[model samples]
Target: TSERILGGLSEQGAPVPQGTAAVISDPVKGNVSEADVSGAAGPLPKAPEPAQIEVLTNPSAGQAAATPVQNISTGIVSAVSGATSERLSSAAAEQGAQLTLEVAAVIGDPVRADVTEAQPVGPDSGNGQSPFSLAFLVNLSGLIGGAAIFFLVGGAAERLEARSLRTSRTGLWTVRLLLGLAYALLIAGAELWVAFGLLGVEHEASTAQVYLFLALATTAAASVTMLLAVAFGPAGIGISAVLNVILGLVSSGGLAPLEALPPFYQAYADWLPLRYVIDGLRSLLFYDGSLDAARLEGGWRDSLWFLGGRSEAARLEDAVWMVGAYLVGAATLGYLISLVRDLFARRERPKTGKVAKAAG
Candidate 1:
């Protein structure tokens, strides 16, 4: 049997059976001869050769080309109609090798290539200006312009008091307060017109709404300054400056959201009149008077804490009330201070007359 062979000789760089030998367990049976083993095994079969595939290369321009088949990547192919195939072949010839296309597998189908052009880059693509830039300018203008009106009104009040001989103390205070308010309204209206009308600044609120908020804020500020000047004399101007310029601007939340500030500042913002003004203006200009929607969503506490809570309606209401309160309070206090001073002067006059009678 072929399985009985133990060794073989090399032929054509591979092993070929030399002979077949048998192993018999019985002592009586003699060992099989090498010639008997050789006769038992047959010749080995011949190995097959590898198959070849043809690859086409680009031909020289001078050479007459064959009907060229487009080289397409391996994928599922779909059938194309005869008319479509003719159109695709003509397009390929016109574009030459510049256009590459994928071929569908249908027997007579033609290949179609989708052509797309690259988009060019532009200089201003991602560099548009932010609305905050305009906001910053407005804030700066408000500070400078508001301060100038305060001083101008203060000077006029001083001149009017010096020239009027018959005007009582009460009358003078009233005149100063009215002058301050008038100045506030004038500056506010002028600045708003210049910014929105002439300069073409963008804002969410209507021009009328902006004017109302600005007028309220400016009047409150101006009234307070006049009251300070009346109470403390010339030194009061510095006090007003510190309050309106330093504390007001920092706590107003104009540069950033109040919530982003430290807890102390956030708390301070609640008491500042400028905060209400700026918040109200922003609600109108940036929020498009939609802060009421916010109040409804967040409830009263949230709306109050964040200075408009949830909506523009709440913000405007709060701003108007706060500014009006400050204006009324300052005017009342100034009037009381003047009345007390007048009372003291009257009481002192009687004492001076009695002393003069004793001396005579």
Candidate 2:
């Protein structure tokens, strides 16, 4: 209508429609009739009518033009839904009422969640979950405790072997095993006391399970270091420190998760006791010792494929058992090597005796 009103006026003045009984007095032309105006202007070209938009009742009609409008409408609806949900959530939160915010989306009425609103893995801290807490567990329990046990056991074993006080290799291994168990238990206990008792850190797992994990980790480290010491002497201590402390710390996946590590570290993540210890601690401390809870709450299910596709229960069980395996395997291997050394020493002693007799 505005287009008609505006477009109808021109340089020749406003053109009257046909059959309009209106008098026109023009400055240049003395008087003008409606017929004269219409005839002169060649039936005053009619203004083009605005297009009337109809509802897109079928998919076949104006699909190209409808697509952008449909997208815009969908976006508007989604934004409004999100805002309304946020408002309701805020209101409920203020009233101390618990509510699950249901977000509405455009596609087939599917719901979309705002993941940012989800709670984080560990305790609610101002800065979110710190890597420092994880590092503290891995370094204190796995690296420092493990390395200390290694040196304590290895140094004692070194002194016995140096003084030739190890009469029976079997007896020596038995002593080492007993000593390792004692030291591991003490280390695990002390560390737990420091963490839970002194630091006031909270854990959502059984104390026995956490203590067992730490003990097994330290025992495994002691077993491996004792094996190296019995086989390689003093050099074994350096090797143990490098393997269980330096390399272990890097590959532990405590500071950075397994997926974030390089491919080589990811490949060997399962073989290392440090990785399992850290993973177990994380599960116990924050995830209630349940792999499913960790996976669901921590968002590790899809990303961390190194879990070997085991069920949640199986994975949680394996985390502890694998460290125990390391302890048993290392201890057994050390025992076997001691047996072989004793056998060779016995054979050499008889040959040397016979040679000395011939010389005499």
Instruction: Highest TM-score: give the candidate number.
Output: 2
Lowest lDDT 10-mer window, candidate 1?
61-70
* Candidate no. 1 TM-score: 0.51
Distance (Å) between predicted and true CA of 357, model 1? 6.3
In candidate 2, which residue pairs get closer than 3 Å at backbone N, Cα or C atoms, i.e. clash? none
> Tens digits of per-residue lDDT for model 2 on 1-360?
222322333332432322221211121122211112111112213332222222222111112222332333333334333444444444445555432222212211222322221223433321222223443343444434434554665568678879866565766677778877887788778877877787656667888878887777777777777777767876876786777667776666544445446767655655566666655675676566775321211223343445443434454566666666677778888889879978987888889889999999
Model 2 TM-score?
A: 0.56
TM-score of each: 0.51, 0.56
